[model samples]
Target: MACMEFTPEHRGTVRLEAREYGRSVLGAPLLYYPCRSACRLLVFAAIHGEEPETTFLLSRCLRAFDTNFEHVAFVLCANPDGATLGTRGNANGVDLNRNFATSNWNPAHVQSRSILESARDTLLSPGKAPGSEPETQALVALIESLKPESVIAMHSPIGCIDAPARTPLVERLQGTLNLPWKPDIGYPTPGSFGTWCSEHRVECITLELPRLAPELLFERYGESFARFLAAQD
Candidate 1:
């Protein structure tokens, strides 16, 4: 694939249009930028609403091209309600990441730290049942439809390229973003999108961006990330 020529004008505006995949709990439309050819990779960001930088950085990367990719698809914001409300969870206060229907799906409430250095004092529901949230259900359906060989779930503040193995995709990302590759995030994540992907035999990579301001993240990785994605096409 040829390198995508960045349009400075498009930087100020979103050029690539999105198609609706599903709706959030608050009835907000869940949108994704579909590929122009058979999808080989699907990269989604903002599954956790509080980490809006994941969405921002991905959006900035998408703005580099006026059209969609030939093989790579994207979901700019997976949890719209949580993002709009600036909450970590959805309108139902359930952590969408923990709502996937995996065999290890737990009904117990999950605790998260207010900050990486803080204690795990904040609590969020894992949904009443597995895949209970509409966002999770819709995302699952979208994956089933696209049938991408690999899926990348974008998250923030952890700053690592996390996958079960350091495959070519992982190596490419590491070289592009200059982030360490970690086979695990050093914690068990039951019912996570990665876990769900593992169960369904889909390769899932968790790209955790370092703790930085959104603008800083874009400045640091925007062009390189866009180029990396373009290369994947």
Candidate 2:
């Protein structure tokens, strides 16, 4: 594989193009940057609107490349409406992460902490049924279409690489990001994307970035992350 050069020009602007995979609850386009060849990995961010740092850091890494990746696809933001509204849940008030159509999908409300140290006081709906929200439905369809062997869902504040097994991809991420690997997030995530991927036999790794300002995260991990992504070929 050729070494990917991180051009300064693209760092200021995203030159790579994106295609629409679906629409959000607010009719905003749900976009993803497809790979040039068959996809082996699919990385997505910002399932929770409050975690915009996930999107920001991923975008910074992406802008380092001028062309499409050969085997890695990216979804910079999965819940646009929620991000727009600055709410953890989407416009429909559903936590998109808990809305996947997995066997453990629950119709009950899910509780999340306002901050890592705070109590789990914030309650968000997990949707009336499994995969009820449009964002969840579209993401499911997109994953099916891409058929990637692995998926990395980016989130933040609890800093660790969460996966069932320490596969090569997990090790690569652990090496590049310098985050500890945990088999679980220490809680039950019933209808989470990771669970969905487990049920479907696709490896899933959750990259929980450490709590930091957006610019700080980019400064710390952006370049290494871009190189890590470029090596996926």
Supply candidate 1's per-residue lDDT for 80. 97
> Given candidate 2, what's the lDDT at residue 37?
82
Identify the leading candidate in terms of lDDT: 1
Clashes of each: 0, 0
- In model 1, how large is the Cα lDDT of residue 44? 97
| Candidate 1 segments whose C-alpha is farther than 4 A from its true place | none
User: Clashing residue pairs, candidate 1?
Assistant: none
Question: After superposition, which runs of candidate 2 have C-alpha atoms over 4 Å from their true positions?
Answer: 1-3
Q: What does candidate 1's lDDT look like per residue over 1-233, in tens digits?
A: 52466676777766776899999998999999998888999999998999999999998888778787889899999999999999999999999999999999999998898899999999999999999999999999999999999999999999999999999999999999999999999987888999999999999999999999999999999999998999999
Superposed Cα deviation of residue 19, candidate 1 (Å): 0.7
Candidate 2 at 116: error in angstroms?
Answer: 0.7
Superposed by TM-score, candidate 2 places the C-alpha of residue 186 at a distance from the truth, in angstroms, of: 0.5
